[model samples]
Target: MSQPQAGRGTFITFEGIDGSGKSTQARLLAEHLRAQGHDVILTREPGGSPGAEEIRALVLQGDPDRWSAETEILLFTAARRDHLERTINPALAVGKIVVCDRFADSTRMYQGLSRGDLRATVDQLHSLMIGREPDLTVLIDMDPDTGHARAKSRQTAEERFEDFGANLQAQMRAGFLSLAQEFPERFRIIDGARAIDSVATDVAQTVSTHLSSVG
Candidate 1:
């Protein structure tokens, strides 16, 4: 679980089950960093670049079982490849912090363990197509039932995954925790069940500590 080299800029990612407030926290962190005079690019996976966004609609707006697990792995990988090429890489190359809402880890959980025993396939494809990992990953951990309730309240078209119910969400939460253990060097687990600002404070401090350590 060696982290990718720190290159010119830092790459940070937020991970959690749906409605874990990870997206909000990612935005908050980006804004906080920018206010501190850091050059930052706030982006999201499955939709960072034009091409990836198109693929995002296809995968996120369909039936719960719209695509097979194998198909999803391919689609996610393709979108990630496009995102890396068109958005993430260039920003990092120019020494700007890239804060992504989600990354390959999502695919690894959604299409890998949730659907089947495909974690190995996800890793293989990631290694072949998208070789970079985040310099730091902020994982917002939450209770599955609460997260599911929050997600369902959104009423967005991208509720395909949420439709899978809280059971899957529980599985995803466990899977993410396992991933944190697997990649301890880059994963920082934060409690997402608290108040929004409180969680954001923890996230900010976690990232601040990571940046200082890396520098």
Candidate 2:
């Protein structure tokens, strides 16, 4: 992975199947960094900026078949472009550590691989519009059944993806692990099946090592 430009802030993203606890981990990491006197911004994809948030509602709610795989990819890419322009890049330019709940990698799995074999289209669009990748990505690996149950228990309108069923969750879990291998330089795998505190400890340690090495 390419290093961030000099004077740029670190970009850290969390990724996993729904209910894998990535969002919680992202929040905790942001808080941890802030308490340690580091400037941090906690955000999430599909909805970091106002415009992107609007798009987020479109893609995250509604029936599972509301949008075609191709359309979903376009929607996600648009949101990401807006997010980078309005939120992520500005923060990084100012040297604030940005902790994001999910990034392009989620799209890679959900829209690119899962919906169909559109990974190439996803990559092409990504390179042309938004070319940034996270400095570090934490993958919270979890069992599909457990993650699916947790996601359903929430009963949120954004359960569109979770509505795909446990099979998709299993597929997503496998896809994420494969993605980690594909980007070993910036990806860290954390076992999310453990207690919340234990998982957070592992995440914290992993990020601390990354920060120290980069510094």
Candidate 3:
């Protein structure tokens, strides 16, 4: 179960709403890369590091009334900071390709939708914390209703943001599209509504081409 170690590798992150298959596709890409004799490290956000996992539980546990808007934002950022130091940056330093399930972009989507004046917050946070952003962000766009349905099918009880309401989710869908448009060079927009295989194919092709270009 040891992954091959390449001389130098890239950092890739998959971002999307729950059930958009970001995690599944992220793993597939890492497996493909690993099979190709590349150094690949796969991890997920809000819980990648040990400290972050504790925060992740609280975030997902749904003490909505107890957790304030600002508290939620800080907790998320705190998790990301830990994730960066404990996993992401270290892997990148070792020339290992880090294929992360989610990253800072989720903050922009989630906190942005939850709070107002998102544009300003994103810039400040980027400059203050996430020193380096993902070279490529694969955004799987999907409807919240459909995604929630699929996510629920696999789980018994929905927790945390599962109750984020239709309006907030609708904003997330639009926000992701707008983000892709605004940062086309950094984002690969994939239609997550497609069949699993179809979406995987699209992502593989895109990542392959990108790797070739960067290589």
Top candidate on lDDT is 1
Write model 1 residue lDDT over 1-215, tens digit each, in one string.
Answer: 33233358999999999999999999999999999999999999889999999999999997998999999999999999888888888888889999999999999999999999999999999998888899999999999999999999999999999999999999999999999999999999999999999999999999999999978
Q: Residue 186 of candidate 1: its Cα lDDT?
A: 97
Misplaced by over 4 Å in model 2 are 1-7
C-alpha displacement of 137 in model 2, angstroms? Answer: 0.4
Number of colliding residue pairs in each model: 0, 0, 0
Q: What is the clash count of model 2?
A: 0
Off by over 4 Å in 1: 1-7
TM-score of 2: 0.96
List clashing residue pairs in candidate 2.
Answer: none
> Quick one: ranking by lDDT, best first?
1, 2, 3
For 1-215, candidate 3 gives per-residue lDDT tens digits of 22222224588989887778899999988888888898899998888999998888887775445576556678888888888878887788778889999887788777755565565666576557666678889999899888776665675343566566556666777887888898888899899898888998899899988989998
Q: How close is candidate 3 to the true structure, as a TM-score?
A: 0.89
lDDT of each: 0.93, 0.93, 0.79
